[model samples]
Target: MTDVVAFLPGNGHVDARLSFAREKAQRLDVGFELRSVDYGAADSFEALLDSVLEQTSGADLAYATGIGGLVYLALRARGALTDQRAILQGPVLWGLETRTFPKLMRLPLMPRALTLAIARGPIQRRFMRKHFTRPLTPEFQRVFFDGYRDARAFERWFAWLTPRLLRDLEQQLRGRPELLDGLTAWWGGEDHVVGIEELRRTEAALGQPISVREFPSWGHYPMIDEPADWTAEVARALAAPH
Candidate 1:
């Protein structure tokens, strides 16, 4: 069976948020796979980048969110996804003007202690609850807490998000605008995490209009807020012609 591959965010958790893609794959009778690299294990950022490139090497249809979306853009810009379809949800390509989390994580060793503190059970729950619309499910919360127990997960994600890397990705996409033809962007109208400005920067960098689907009432976690609706939308996108 063909696969509907999803590249997960930095935490690398196969959490409840991915069920939308899994259900859509089932409706299409395709396999579902969650892809993630251990940023914590990589010796250097280049190694992590290479792993991400390899993880997303080839796919008929792919789903990526946040940092994963950035990885997808890098691959697309490099001509690695010429004929594949990509569903990018809340891609953080730019728009860091107001966000302090990414900026703080990129700091020196001081952030390690901070990341570990945030990884603690209570803090993680509070942070996640803020982003989600509804209460967290037991299953979802279990995996989420388990996934971030290792502080390095958070540490390496920021390590990979250096300004130099972001600049290089923007330059590549701008230089080869044709490479992004197969991308479809999904955004929650109320999403504050990767808000409208980030989406605009993505379009500006690619130099082409992106196909976008906006969810009026949803925040950053549409799958957690309205799983069935998001799953149906995924099905529609997969069934639609490329």
Candidate 2:
């Protein structure tokens, strides 16, 4: 029996990662597993590698769902991960510069920041329906709030990362070049995290139209927004090629 593994950065939500894989697995009639990088387990690079080697095993294919995982996919394409094929999804191109160093100009950030703060603050204990404490998704609020006993324990669990994360992100922003030369990118137009234009630019800069898929109304995490459609496209792409 063939299996497909879905991977993500440890800080990422398990619900989101598994939701993407399990939905697609059901559609493709394949076995699925959720693997996560363990950030807490590594203080240095060598230790990080050992941890990744321990957790990430080859599969029929691995769906690399975010910037951290997509970077790993490109490295895997170059033979770092010799045992599996990788699918890149909604990859973040400029993280340190665009995402964290400073907020992007045209988007709303204060709301998100406040949302996160209130979600984890003292008010969280008393205000179930308070505006600041509530999340975008009513059903998912508990998944994030109640899923972790405390933030510290949740952050330490996944101790491995797909090896390409920092290196690729570092290189690309330095204007080194496109790492997508031999990789396929899967994206959606409605994805707020990585815009459609960014994906187009990446595909163009790579000098080829690698595979691209778009959806309507589904933001960054379309697997959760539009599961059935995402599943259909995923099955088709996995069956296509490296």
User: Tens digits of per-residue lDDT for model 1 on 178-224?
Assistant: 78877888899878777867878767755667888888888877766
Q: Which 10-residue window of candidate 2 scores lowest in summed lDDT?
A: 154-163
lDDT of 2: 0.49
Candidate 2: residue 27 Cα off by (Å): 7.9
What TM-score do all the candidates reach, one by one? Answer: 0.81, 0.60
* Runs off by more than 4 Å, candidate 2: 9-11, 15-40, 70-79, 100-139, 145-182, 200-211
Instruction: Give candidate 1's whole-model lDDT.
Output: 0.67
Clashes of each: 0, 5
Q: Tens digits of per-residue lDDT for model 2 on 1-81?
A: 544554544233544434544656576664444455443435654554455545566555556655444346435434455
| Superposition error at 174 for model 1 (Å) | 0.9
lDDT of each: 0.67, 0.49
